[model samples]
Target: MNEQERMTRRRFLKACGLGLAGLSLSGYMTYLFGGTSVKDVLKSTLGGTGADGFRALENFRINSVEPTPNVQLADYRLTVDGLVANPVTWSFAELKHALTEVEQVSDFHCVEGWGIKNVRWTGVKMRELIQQVRPMQTATHVTFYSLGGVYTESLSLAEAMEEETLLAYGIYGKDLPAPQGYPLRAIIPRMFGYKGAKWVYRIEFTDHQHLGYWERYGYNVDGVTAR
Candidate 1:
């Protein structure tokens, strides 16, 4: 990685309190060794129970470095474009009103070893959105972009169409908290948490795979959970 990217990663790891940036735990090895350290820290910080059966702040790994972006619902728009027959953008209200929202209970696996089980996520299925946009035949991948503008993640078209792929807006029967990406986040239950781009604002259908923020740092591109 370049020096700037290296520094960026260091900042992110530092924010997560992981301190694993210097380790050579690239790709699958990241999950093998990094998981142990994350679990230890999580166990030591435990407290009272929270919603969705999570303990304390266990609902999601905290990214304490970057302040949460103030997203205005009235001005928020999710754009779908790229290799698709129909390009469209939707306001938060329109997205919710036009798409069917579904709720599902699933486990969120983190590559760092910590995880939350049976998370109650409410959102629109990605397949439904894909059907609406109608990807071109050449479109084999789908990239999700965060509103923060720095974070992006991708999935194969087939993977994006998976039953568990959701564009979530609520968790535990409440609107998402600022720390949890507020307005929206992508949930790919089968992959590690990093594959789920929080604060999603754009969906692009592409002919080629797009490397995500962590992928450039040598984390597995697919980011499927090891277990």
Candidate 2:
């Protein structure tokens, strides 16, 4: 669909009251039917209470409206640099093809105390990428950078290597919605959503510990949950 049509659908979903359950159903239907448009997929995938609340937090504005240098698939490049021996730049399609696809069904919990019911995600294992990068002995943390200026997050080498952590390309069985971080987004299960950085653009292998945007703003950096 064109940009204008996409925008109109986003506006409609924002104004609707279907909550998360209805949104999940919509996403399921869209995935099953091959002919659904991008706008329709978005209306369904983004249809959830957590999304509604998040949109409200942003004053109902679609967060992806602004073009970030890092988020565009055409202009987007995931730079695997810093401490790596072979610093690489990957196009979205290149990365999509290079990585193996894996499916995950897990509960998504937000630090705000709201949780989405089980959802399935399709993406590549982050460990696989790290293995490919082969960080040097000095690299201790993996810092994530988004297209928008200075929006960053970090994970210790250990956290970054988790088998469950993924650089996700699809959600609920379809391509991700832009607001939900299309092209790619990080999904670290059991952590707060902020730790799952949205609109992800780059991955920097770092030797020093660093605080991300939210971490610097007082959200917990080590987002481990206590059961």
Best-fitting candidate, measured by lDDT? 1
Q: What lDDT is obtained when candidate 2 is compared to the true structure?
A: 0.73
The candidate 1 region of ten consecutive residues with least summed lDDT is 47-56
lDDT of 1 by residue, 1-227 (tens): 89999999989878766535435334345343223355534453452235424442343677523568899999999999999999999999999987999999998888877776678889999999999999999999999998878888999999999999999999888888888887999999889888888888999999999998888878888787342
Residue pairs that clash (backbone atoms under 3 angstroms), model 2? 20-48, 20-49, 70-147
- How do all models score by TM-score? 0.76, 0.68
**Clashing pairs in model 1, backbone N/Cα/C closer than 3 A:** 35-112
lDDT of 1: 0.82
Error of 2 at 5 (Å): 69
Q: All models: lDDT?
A: 0.82, 0.73
User: Could you give the C-alpha RMSD of every candidate to the true structure, in order shown?
Assistant: 13.3, 15.1
Residue-level lDDT tens digits of model 2 in 86-148: 667888888878778999977676665555545678899889898888899999998887767
